[model samples]
Target: MTGDFTARVTALLMPHLILAPIALPMLTAGLMLLLREERQRTKVAMNVVSTFLGLVVAVLLLVQAKQPGVQTSLGVYLPGNWPAPFGIVLALDRLSAMMLVLASTVALATVLFSAARWHKAGVHFHPLFQFQLMGLSGAFLTADLFNLFVFFEIMLAASYGLLLHGSGRPRVAAGLHYIAINLAASSLFLIGVSMLYGITGTLNMADLARGIAGIDPSDRGLLHAGAGILAVAFLIKAAVWPLNFWLVPAYSAATAPVGALFALMTKVGVYSILRLWTLMFSSGAGDSAQFGSQWIVGAGLVTMCFGALGMLGSQRLGHLAGYAAILSSGTLLAALGFGQNLLTAGLLYYLLGSTLAVSAMFLLTDLIERWRNDGASLAPHEQTDDAPFLAADLVHTQGLNLDEKEEVLIGQVIPAAVAFLGLAFLACTLVIAGLPPLPGFVGKFAMIHALLNPLGLGSSGGFVLGSGGWALLALMVGTGLLALIALTRAGIRHFWASHDRAAPKLLVLEGLPIALLLTGCALLAWQAGAVMRYTQATADALHAPGTYVQAVMSARPVPNSPGTAPGANGRPQ
Candidate 1:
């Protein structure tokens, strides 16, 4: 009886388990909508439970993804028992599973952080939060371009609410700009998707991969055009230079928790790029292999340089974090442009570590600024008759002072709170600067090592350190130095420059989540070997598009009735 019960439980959950990541938050959001507005605590409890369950489900999926028997993307779920390329499908692979895990972790952290105050700042906060998670999870797990678009809209709509939560004039203005740019990008998304369908007759990514190689020579130009247009939309969303002006302003204006969540948003665009490029333009695609590679590298290099410089000039910590996000995106794009499996492996690890650190930076920025708002700033603001050390705002003119307020007071609760903030800020600095003994340093070191010694890591062949590799290596080191100098200077100003320093009251909810995210970085460092192995395996799978195509296109629909579907189909739905 116990064995029977265990078997029954496994049968019920295992088949549909992949859907849980996407479905749980969606159901939670709907349930939250049903609750009356007065039961705020109940709503909070529901949100937390749902998010925690989603994270648990994501981890389980990751474990299954690593299981044997599949070339890639372990679990493929077709809604309503429809076949692939004909119906909505959600699939999981090492890469997608990793992303799902990352998104869920960020969701849990931000939600926990919000519980302190941000959630209660506006109505419908709980529902919107769940909706955002639903969208993010769906985006990561989706198997087709159409569903990807749908999830993007879902995510953006919720972000529209979250970004403008506790609306003020600053938020309103930034929110409007954010909404307008994304709306335009969404338009481009539709246009590009339509073009791809017109050319290939399918919107399923795996299907496209299989179909693109067999297309007529005459349609090659159109295919590239369609993909280029689509890339423009992604590039805009990813905050590449020349189209990234909205990122810093919009991200900086958001509340702490919302801003922390937004840390993962740009990565979605980067993920989209990675997914499409690998599937459609991998080395196997004959003439189309590595299409537009140079442009991607150029854009990434420009964005990295821009972000590094912008960060140096930033007086506000919020802006610094925003610029750091742009820098991370650029790094991924540039590394990915190389199209080497080992390089891809390193960047994947970098992506995870950098995103966590950047999210922590956003949270810490809010805390430090709050201290300034509470008149506990250690730095002097403006010129005084006796001593005028001159703050950054005074030195760089008023333009650098986006929202830095000048206040001064010494308070009692200084020793402990200030120490915590100081240590957290220092960790953020170390991570951002790619200093030793953190996952950030490990990630960068891995990428550089892979680039310089591809054959040393059991590679099947040799790689040339071309001009591009040299350039990337130089920028990686240079940017780290710049970040260290800028962040260290900001730390000194925030923690020691002024005599009116004090510790402001930090809620347990607020401090705990920040510590949790940083602790994640610590764990990543401690387990770097295992994490790197997983990432390397993921990269190997991604570079082989044929495996992805075979897996996705061969997936069949689950039969509901004898006549509805065939039972002997490939990759049981």
Candidate 2:
């Protein structure tokens, strides 16, 4: 028994071993802002540092992969010797590490992409960008809910400045909406936190988990209500349906690098949902143990349908991508809510692949626009000699005479590249739609299998909504088909149409970032199995909350930070 306990503790602490590796770039970036004398030197320094950060995170993830359990919880630093559950605690289980790696890679790529142009306009872009990275890394690593909120606010505040970097009317307007919506969500987040503290008398997640395990019968309703309210904050962040109006405008208005960074924002919301559901509301080992996750699945189904529809209808390329991301988020939520281990695993892979692909697309869009603006095209605009070729006008041209090589290259090479990225995203959508051959199909299949079981949802906690599963399946298929059709049509129009006028040549600086992203996406396709294994392991960890509580409760207390004593309700006791 003692050996088993020690093994669990070791498993929980393993993930944090690489924290310093990840934090190096963030600290360097911050320090450079004050010390670096020249803008050119500072930008160069930031790029190298950010790239190093990515490499470190990649290494950490690789190390974590070699380990079996993939769990780690860091008690407060014990700075000056403090006690834990009271000190600032940092934790990195499978989910946190997965998210950290994703965020790190995306940030590094964007920073690399922006290296040449970030400081072009005499702004302190490097420092702000570095701070943003810090905020993101901290948000993923922190275990405390309040600290998570603080980190989120830090990121958002940095994002607001970054979004309005160029000082345009559209960007300024979008920033307002972004700020307003997020502020509202933040308010609700605090309110939910207050309610939880008042009732449970503890804020530590592990403590809250133990507390939730033994809730009073009469207070369960109140606890559920608080949970529901807290969920609303995350939903708003996730850009889930009915609360997703802010996503399109905000994403479209931000620059490509900014947009790419924003791609990780939704995962933050999903992370909270996963943590809360797994730790606080997990089903127990009894005939009566049903946590009512079907509601989450139902929400996921609707979100998937609505998101796909929105993506199809969007006119602008940026807005289309925005809608597509929302659709993807919906699918992710639905998959997790589906309450099948396979589906959760699928969701994990889909998020990783989709973020890489969409982020690349966002960055690529900027490059395309820049190339068109830089006069790399064979045919310059007849009327506006100086301005970039109008994207809409390019589509309006009827036909053009081109050499065979040009035809092959334009029709084949460029489209193939774009198509490759599109397919990566399409794979993600297909998975969301629960299609076969992809993880999504596997996940959906598993979910259906679970639901069909006699003792599963159909048992005591079951709500008999006739044909609900079939209806959801039909919606998934229909929307999946529409999204594919829409994407294919757009691809044909953008890539195949014979405008005869070359828009621009690709720049190494502008194009390489996306190329890196495409490579990662392809790798995701290749390594789907390993990715799914990680996801399944993560889901298993989530389902079993005892391991998490035990690790935190038994860890050495940090000096000056007192343990949260259990309340009268047996919560945290």
lDDT of 1 by residue, 133-236 (tens): 88888888898999999999999999999999988998999999999999999999999999999999999999998877788899999999999999999999
**Candidate 2 structure quality by residue, lDDT tens digits, 1-573:** 999999999776543454553366566666767664466665666656766656676557555644654333342232212234675556666777787778878877887777757544436666667767777777766667777788888778878888887778898999899999999998888988888877888777877877775777777777777777888889899888888888889888888888888888887888788877767765652321335467666776777777788868865667667876787787677656645554455567777766776677677666544533453334443646534345434433635433533232234345444454445445444443445565545544544554455245323223333465565556656766766666666655554555444445444665667767766666665677677677767766676767766766665642222564432111110
Per-prediction TM-score = 0.91, 0.80
Relative to the true structure, how large is the alpha-carbon lDDT of every model? 0.85, 0.65
> Which prediction has the highest TM-score against the true structure?
1
Tell me the spans in candidate 2 whose CA falls farther than 4 Å from its real position: 1-18, 35-38, 65-83, 118-122, 285-295, 370-468, 558-573
Choose the strongest candidate by lDDT.
Answer: 1
Candidate 2 lDDT: 0.65
